[model samples]
Target: MTRSSHSLRTRDLGYAQRVCVAKAGKLMMQTGQLTPRARVGLAVSGGVDSLAMLAVMAIRRRIVPFPVELLLLHLNPGFDPHNHRPLVELCAGLGIPAHIETTDFGPRAFSEENKKNSACFYCAWLRRKRLFDLCATYGLTHLAFGHNADDLAATFMLNLFQNGRVDGLSSRESFFSGRLTVIRPLLLIDKPTIVRAAKAWELPVFSNPCPMAGKSMRHEAETWVRSICAGDKHRNVSLQHALGRWQLDRDALPD
Candidate 1:
């Protein structure tokens, strides 16, 4: 039985539909990512990637496998809480509940770190901790981040050169401390997919400068990736494909 997006409530989708919230709902099912009844706690930073993923997941709720009930969790580590309003509006328009919270990750902590290295490493580490804590508080089992394939590839290369690791971000990981599972549904998608989808769907962009945007190494990497993509078109897509194929050929490469 086929169902349109109009027929879905917050609880109709099954497990298979939860992780592959943006792609064909059956992808995860066919791959056995989840059973028939999984719930996902999505993290939305009010960015194009996160917003795009949110909209896609909303549409996916009317799908099969598992109904993904999105609980928008926003953590203001150093970014403005007001900067997240667009996400609130987007959720409201989508008729989903969005929650906001602020953590006192003092500005000093970020400023001090920004001097030696990009602010992202420290800030992101903290935000992730906050996000995980929120998931535990809400009793949400699976937590999703909006990291697309582009991010994975860039980070992988960056880590290879800088961190001496062959890993970037894992598709599915269990938080070492909390053992909470984290996933990336959009890991196969890229910035173009996100940008086009956000514009096409009119996803609200939260106007906030992540305190370490231009100064962060990941942001720098993103800029570099975009610059190269602008000059040579295939760099972006090729990297994305490489990531997927690499994972397929060797799901667990010895690190």
Candidate 2:
């Protein structure tokens, strides 16, 4: 890429980032969960999704007409001990406080003791438990995740096929009798949009260190869901609406 071309690409990416942030912020405001003065714990996993979520939330905090404090939280999962510095630095650059917890959740999940459940299941359960504990520890009013619309659809299919139910991921779920709310601001944003925005913003997205990174049930479900959507943005959004998880306006995209 030539210097001018590279600069143009960067500018386009910056515009993509702005659009993503605007859509995310709009969805968050629609949910009415991210209130003023809310202390939110953002779960950053070093993946493009979570990293992009961090950037979107950080930017939204600044431009939105509210005073919300964001804290970046990462659980190392014992797979890589030295991979958290980039996330910490990113949080620093965004002027958000970060808390990194180094745990052996990954290894333990694959241990023999965890025989019944899949490693992904065990690892995710433990990670969520720790995140919830951190939220309580920090007295955070909300915990934000990077799960997007595609995740919601795949999860719905996963549950329907595996458990035989209509249960799907909720955009806003309350926990601890409403003391701490779990919010998915990207719930209405599709995965491709997130990928594009992440690329434009040049987030420090690292490869998944989990041994079963692309070999899990969830991965299979995601692949199947992608094929079902077949790169159609409208199909992706319609699937999310059909799952009854989101009530977005017809003009979902920001002008």
- TM for every model, in the order presented, reads 0.78, 0.87
Which runs of model 1 end up more than 4 angstroms from their true locations? 1-27, 30-34, 106-108, 111-118, 176-179, 223-230, 249-255
Backbone clashes per model, in order?
A: 8, 0
**TM-score, model 2 to reference:** 0.87
239 Cα displacement, candidate 2 (Å): 2.5
- Model 2 weakest lDDT span, ten residues long: 1-10
lDDT (CA) per prediction: 0.63, 0.79
lDDT of prediction 2: 0.79
Which digits, one per residue and each the tens of the lDDT, describe model 2 over residues 71-185? 9989999998888877765665566799997899999998997999989999999999999999999999999999887787888789889889766666677899999998888
Cα lDDT tens digits for candidate 1, 165-194: 787666666565644667666777666656
Residue 120 CA displacement from its true place in model 1, Å: 2.0
Best by lDDT: 2
RMSD of each: 5.7, 5.1
Question: Candidate 2, 70: how far from true, in Å?
Answer: 0.6
